[model samples]
Every structure is written in C-alpha cells, then in structure tokens.
Target: MSINWDDLKVALAIVRHGTLSAAARALGTTQPTVSRRLDALERSLQAKLFDREAGGLRPTALVLALVGGLEQMDAGAFSIQRQVAARDTGLSGEILVTSLDWLGDDVIAPMLARFGAAHPGVQIELINGTRVFNLARGEADLAFRFGSFEQENLIERRVGEVAYALYASTEYLQQHGTPDVGDGFEGHRLVYLDRAAGEVPHEAWLPALARHARIVLRSNGLRAHMAAVRDGVAMAVLPCLLADREPRLRRVALPHPAPVRWVRVGFHSDMRDTPRIRALVDHVVGEFELLGACLNPKQ
Candidate 1:
C-alpha cells in the first residue's frame, strides 16, 4: 500500500509537539485519532518511528531522517497554496490586523487610515489587545509583535525596534524626586504589567529595578499602566513611542541602557503573497521605516 500523506502529516505534528494530545490540538483532531494514524504509519513503514520516554515521545533516528524531507514538502505545499490564493484577482475583502492597544492612538491608526483611503475596496479590521493574536489559526490576518518568533509554517519580517524607559508623571517626580542611577528604586512605587501580559523581554528586567520599590499597581494593558502613571499614581517603564511624546511625563535616565525590542510583522506562510495581506505587510513596513527613529530612539 502507498504511504498516506494524511498519516504522515499526523506523524509530523506528533513529532513537533512530542505528545499525541498536543499534536491533536495542533491538527484539530482527537488524541485517539492521532494515535491511530501514528500506529498506522508505523505499521506501513514497518519501523518504530518514536520511543515513548519519561519526558515525552522521542523520534527515532529513522524518523529524524524523514523529518527534513517532510519539512521541505510542507514548505512546497504552503507555497503552492499561497500561489493559488494569490490568483484571486479582486483585492476587495476584509483583512484583520492585530496589534498592541497603544498603537491605536498614534502609530498604526494613521497608517491604517491612509491604507483605507487608498484602497477603499479592502476592509481593514484592527484588533487591539494585550495578547498576541494567533495568525496560523486565522485569528488575525497579520500581527505586529515584539521579540523573536519561532512558530513553524509562518513568515515574519523585522520592521523596527521598540525602546523602553522608566517614566513618571511630573507631579510624582517633583514630589518624590527622580530615581538616580543605581539607587535600587528606593522610595519608588511602581506601576507594572501583570504576569498575564508580561511576555515581553523588557518586562522581565523590571523586577530587578523594582526589587526594592513597592509595586503599587499591576495592569495587563499598556493603556491602563499609562493612565496610572499619568495620574501620578506610580512610576512605570513605558515604551518610548508612547511616553516620549507626553509632556506630562519624564523619562528617567538609568545607569544601564534601556531595553530594546525587535518589532516583527508576521503572517501565515500560506497567506504571505495574497493580495490583501501583501498590501498590508508592505504598507506597515514602509510606515515603520518612516518612523523608525521615533519608535527606537537612541539610548
């Protein structure tokens, strides 16, 4: 019997995730179905593809040998799918773009508005939230993200970098005095991001700075954190793109250089070349290039 591509795909997913349940979740199937397909594939090939281990399922040498070819096939299949999608001549359709909430005010909002005016046929749905929207599952057509992305079967381009700095309202600074370099946050109250929305690399460094200071408020949203800081509730580490422009706030110079995060634009590989997706990606990249200096100011 010929090898079934469907069964091979299941095996690939299992190998990638290291568990039947996780593979099922990625494949949108049940664990039982994944197990059945994996068993069938092993039987057809007459080879033990994986060894169940205490930690997780480990692929055998033979299975490892097959993975490289499978990945190449996956890429080719995705390329063909994208080519087919690109065949749609008409550009009129709804394309969703997901980004952090702060960008809605000054950064992406204007670029999206200009895109709308230029291409009135294509509808743009801008989703602003604290979490990164899933691009592979169609939750968003495109995403503006920070840090390194490692998900397979997706494409990303680095658009720019985001710089972060300690910021406080003028009233708070005047009342408590600014934190000098290497002061260990003495007598400071911090308004910080909650753990739920604390995946950014810079957020991890905040605990060290606020180790001595008291955490007065923790928020999952940048807008809330900004509001707290602006209201003179507490000091916060904020993005330069947002805080630098505010006249009421001041950037506290730290002994160390402020953290910088890479801004990446990501989308599913299968939709990379689609007309609407391509247009959005190109426009956003150009917009970032135009505002790169502001987004990533020299520290």
Candidate 2:
C-alpha cells in the first residue's frame, strides 16, 4: 500500500515526541492537524502504531518494526533531494561533519582546509564535541567516530587507529621524577579526563601507576587536560596523537596505555555514492594515510 510522505512524517514525529502536541510543535502545525494526519496514516496502514497509556502514546511493536523501514525511506528521499541540489548547483552545498573536539582540531581541521581549498564552492561545517552525534537522526551528514559501530544500513570504514600514552610537563617530570609500577604515585597529583574519572577503564588503568595516587584535577576536555599538564597542574594520560605534537610535554611511562582504538568514518549507505560525500571520504582516507605515523606512532 502506498503511504503519503506527509502522513508518515507526522506519524513518525508523534512517535518520537510521545504526544500529539509536542509533535505539532516540532512540525510547526496545530495539534489537531498532527492528530488528523496520524489517524489517516493508521487508517491507510490498517494497523495501530501507538497505544494510549497513562504516561503517553507508546509505540507498539508494529511501529518499532516499521520505523526502521520508514527511516530508510526518509534517508532515501533526502539523498534524492541532495543529489538534485548538487546537480543543479554543481557541488556547491554545505556538508555537516561531526567528530570529537580534539580529533577535529588535530586531524580533521587540516584535511578540511585541503578539502576546502580543492572544493572552494563546497562549504564544510564542523561540529566538534564529546557527545556522539546521531547520524540516523540526521544530526550530521558525516561522522568521524572512534571505536566500533554496529548500526545497520550504514557505511563504516576504519580510517585509522589511535594510541594513548601517559604524559606530563617537563617541569613536573623534573620535580616529581618518572613514575613506574612501584613508584609512590601518592607523592604526585594526577590529572584526568573528567568524563573518564571513576570509569572502570580509567580506574584500572590510572591506579596501575601507584596504589595511592590522588586525582587532583579533572577536565571533560582532552585539550584542557593536556593544557593542565603543560601548565604543571598534574600529569595525565593522553592520546599520543596529541601528546607527541606538544613541545612542552614528555612521555612519562607506559603505566596503562589503553588498547589502540579504531577511527571510523561513517555515512548512510545511500549517501556513499554521492560525489561530494565520496570525495570527502577519499580525501580523509588519504590524509589519514599520510599522517598515520603521527596519529598511530610505533611506540
């Protein structure tokens, strides 16, 4: 059976927002219009997509099963629109790319400069943050993610690998001496990523330096933590890609270099063939190849 796009959009919006009024607000329409469209959609499908409960309209199993297909269809429609726009304007459009803040600065920024130089007509918008951007929800057109992803109907390529190492300021190293497995870490303060503190990995890894080391400072930002190290606030474990580039920092000891993590560039499978997206992927892959030694050092 043929489904109207508008009705499908309304139905999906309602399911997402949990209430007709919220969906209406999202769609910039009245609650009655949203309710009417959802009713029409249910009538056309001859299925109950949601159940009215005390909490709100809860999506049924049928809705969950169908939502994936509907989302795929929506992605396809957007791909078509993007293709048409690119064709009409000759690749002169904006592409949104998301990545971790430090990676964006240390890795993606240079590649973006080269890409921009080559494709002057194309505009690139980079969103750098610690939060993972939802590609399925169209939060970003492309993402450079670290670690593994198992999302279906998406294209993921292992672009590179990153290694972490313990680092400290030259001044701190001189004052406190190098820490080893038996060293009394309690003698020196520790700097850690605020997001990683109390995390099992961090707890297991950092404490390996010493049994009684205290975390004196924590920051949610890699750059900030590295800066703290440079400023002689405390020593921190940092990605080698960033540490190796800093002039004032020195590698202290292996202590607990977390396992290397894979860096992946991901995009919707349908968008893989788009010229602009393909060009970007190729450029990033090439850039990583050129800089792999720096990002994933032998040590």
Top candidate when judged by lDDT against the true structure = 1
**For every candidate structure, what is the RMSD over all alpha carbons to the true structure, in angstroms?**
6.1, 4.9
TM-score versus the correct structure, for each prediction? 0.66, 0.72
Give the poorly placed runs of model 2, Cα more than 4 Å off: 1-8, 19-93, 134-138, 195-204, 255-259, 296-299
Leading candidate by TM-score: 2
Candidate 2: tens digits of C-alpha lDDT, residues 1-299: 87899998887787778998999987789999988898888999999989988877899899888788887887787667644543534556778998887888878878987898899888999988877766655567788977555666678998876777677888988898777567657578787666544463433466655666678877777767887899987888787777887899887756344546667998766576667787888888887778666665554
Candidate 2 positional error at 30, Å: 11
lDDT of 1 by residue, 161-181 (tens): 678888899999999898754
**lDDT of model number 2:** 0.77
Taking all chains together, the TM-score of candidate 2 against the true structure is: 0.72
